[model samples]
Target: NVYADSIEWMSRHLNHRENVILSLHPHNDRGTAVAAAELGYMAGADRIEGCLFGNGERTGNVDLVALGVNLFTQGIDPQIDFSDIDQVKRTAEYCNQLPVPERSPWAGDLVFTAFSGSHQDAIKKGFEAMDARAAAEGVSVDELEWAVPYLPIDPKDLGRSYEAVIRVNSQSGKGGVAYLLKTDHAIDLPRRLQIEFSGVVQSTTDAEGGEVTSDQIWAIFTDEYLPSQVADERWGRFELLGTRTSSDMTGDVELHARLRDGDDVEDTTGHGNGPIAAFLEIVRGRGFDISLYDYVEHTLSAGGDAQAAAYVELQIDGERLWGVGIDGDISTASLKAIVSGVNRAIRTRQLESRLAAV
Candidate 1:
């Protein structure tokens, strides 16, 4: 209010001045320097002078970066080049020897990140929709109106990528995990599989009591779902050799599979309503009790050789688990998903036995 009254008095006194610049120099004594500067501008001040990042005597001057970015977000051009804010922040930190707060407005490390479940979901959907709209309109993403949830301005506008926009910790949910996988690895998980994997991520983060990086998340995913390496022997008990399917005139599907259990190899066949059902019958005949609870599949890319990803949820004994598989063929991907699930179930049993022994 004092700044406003001063600006009003100055404007009235300088009415007849031919060449005078009414400037504002606000201090941070009350932590209202930015507000005073803006209000002074509205009250007919022609110029604003402040230190960068609010660094000055007392509480420091108004932050020019924050003030300019705030105006830019409101569709007003502040005529400042802040596209590479990281560079600006680095230079400021080096010269001033003061660390920027992680939660500082518009310029902090965690400013654009969302850790909550609902916020992650909304941001994930918003990015997907925005990309789709840009593709449909045949324009660059920057040309479109920025309307993502929880983000006042697009990170790309500030020379930042979406990689760090949604980080996962114990507080995160399924959507955050799915968003990370999709953005980093081009693996779009099914909703149910996301829910299943969120539990795994939660346990990992809880045990570690920290943020889980993308590499660690990928390792966990591969350990649970993908084909194991030489170090992982617990899941290679049963290896699939080949598979063929046929349908009779009565529409009964018969599936033939060549399998290897340890050093022994055999060919087995079963009949049911579909390939999955027939395969389950064959596995049932081999003394493993498994039931398929849910299934989802999608193409991994938009090209001719694009891979297909399949997710399978299985119930073994009383435990429920999910597995993922990727291949060039959709059918093969689905079959591999089932095999992955069976291996995971076997691994779970082995772990359980070890715990019981201990």
Candidate 2:
């Protein structure tokens, strides 16, 4: 700050001098070199001296990347393109044989990240608002103003997806966990379900005393919602090998399916008003106390050849559970969903029996 005052006074007196080029060079010894440089620039400094990533002796120099990005965020073209910040950081590190710090200004790994519960919630809401605005205005989110809580600029501008912005730690809450699930897996949870699953995630993180990655979150989600057999074996006990269905003019539906349960296989037929109903009837006839409580089919994406996702809620022997399935064919996906729910209930009952015996 003292140097800043001196620079301003000298620049004012030397402004009218012929052929005078005023330059300001600040070091990071006080850890305010970047701030001092900015202030000196505003006070009439002609040039700043620094290196990439602030790499220098005695706690590094004024970071040029930080300065350029600072100018970029303020809508000023610093004539330096940090569009590929990772490449720049890598080059700097390779040339200097010194790695950049993880918290180095805008180029840091978590410069735009928010790990706190409230911060994550605010960032999530901010993204939603930005998306809504982009949609209403007929533009990409990148085209709109880059504003999100705890993040000064979009990491995308720096060639970073940074989906890990809301890192999941033991202190994280539902919003942060839910955000990662949707961002990474395209699986959006209902508010109630989000709260419930957040408890599971909290317990896991607390026991581990570490951060949970997005992939781990997805694994937990599948373990909780998909068929236990499928979760492990990739095919459940009640696997739908094949199916043939026909509808008559009288509005009656008949479905014949080759179903497998462990080592046994059977070709069974059932009749109902619809194919799904007929399939459920066949499953019922197999001596499984299962009934479809609710079925929801949602689009995963708007792309052609995209697989359909089915959510099946089944009421089995007075208890209910949810299962999910995905396939190219809607019918197969829906039936797999039923089988998934059935397999899940069967697995739960088996576990209970084993526990009772123990």
Candidate 3:
């Protein structure tokens, strides 16, 4: 509704042009505040009003930063400058001013980054193309890189430094090497090196089965600088059980795991159907039927020592539960995931039982 339409509207008497910078303040009280704000934008409002990070009254208001970026991506330049969004974000955190979770879209740690090999490959290709475009156009690479895929807008446009573009951790991919190298050493490893190094990293991390650090990568790279095919470093062991190898090499392997859990006696061998499956089977066999519903796995570290973590949703017929597990071994991680799911199931069932008794 136009501000002029209000019963006591007086601003309408003043000159307000059609090309106006309209702002929206959405309250979470009704949850439609953001939607209403977007509606205003759609109705040709030039500017949207919002708090720096959506810090406002109960449930907060619209996140202006997110909205601004979204507008920028849509080719509508947000005239309001927030070139140093990162600094602003940090300040917001340092002041204990807000509770912005890392999972928040556009501003989260994991938003632009990917872990799966396929996703990494795609992002790498996208940046490569963007780089090529800038080279061909003779424009600043900063200008060209803005249109790269996955990224809504050029991070630089919002004053974000390249340092935060990609973070290499256990869950990272070969692209991570390029990301880190570009940021840390101002050197971009050629494609061949990235490919060769990924396998090295995977093997080194998987075998050692521990956290791999930047220093370790540099040491390994210096020690064994091979054009291709370096011998396996044999960092850790993956114990296989149950499934027999079909001559073709494409079959599911049932995984049962013996994991190091704290001190000696607490060490246990959980089971699951798949990796987690066999792990669950082992646990159920031990008289603990951890009812599980959902499980999600993601790589944690970048190159070597990438830890796989599993979050399992569980609910017993009459109880409630929650469980989580992590390990270098994907299968072992799956086992932990199942345990988590089972625990959640127990919790749910228990909740139901209590409700029924009441």
Query: What ranges in model 1 sit over 4 Å off?
Result: 1-20, 138-140, 230-236, 350-358
Which residue pairs in model 1 clash with each other? none
Q: After superposition, how far is residue 19 of candidate 1 from its true place, in Å?
A: 5.3
Which digits, one per residue and each the tens of the lDDT, describe model 1 over residues 199-311?
A: 98999999999898888898888877887667546455666678899997898998898977767999999888888888888878877888999888888789999999988
lDDT of 2 by residue, 1-358 (tens): 6877888899878856556778877789989989999998888788888888888779777989889889988999888877899998888889888877788798878787777888888898888899899999999987887888888888887888867689888888988988997677766665555676788789899999889999998887777656444434644567787889999999899999998878898999989988889988998887877777777776667788877777777787777776667777888888888887788778878889999999
Model 1 clash count equals 0
Winning model by TM-score: 1
Which tens-of-lDDT digit does each residue in 179-233 have in candidate 3? 5544454434545446656666777877777555556666665433311134443
Q: Judged by TM-score relative to the true structure, which candidate is superior, 1 or 3?
A: 1
- What TM-scores do the predictions have? 0.89, 0.72, 0.48
Order of all candidates by TM-score, from best down to worst? Answer: 1, 2, 3
Where in model 3 is the C-alpha error above 4 Å? 1-24, 29-36, 44-49, 94-96, 105-116, 143-145, 178-193, 204-215, 226-358
The TM-score of candidate 2 is 0.72
Colliding pairs, model 2: none
Return whichever of 2 and 3 wins on lDDT.
2
lDDT comparison, 1 vs 3, better candidate: 1
All models: lDDT? 0.86, 0.81, 0.56
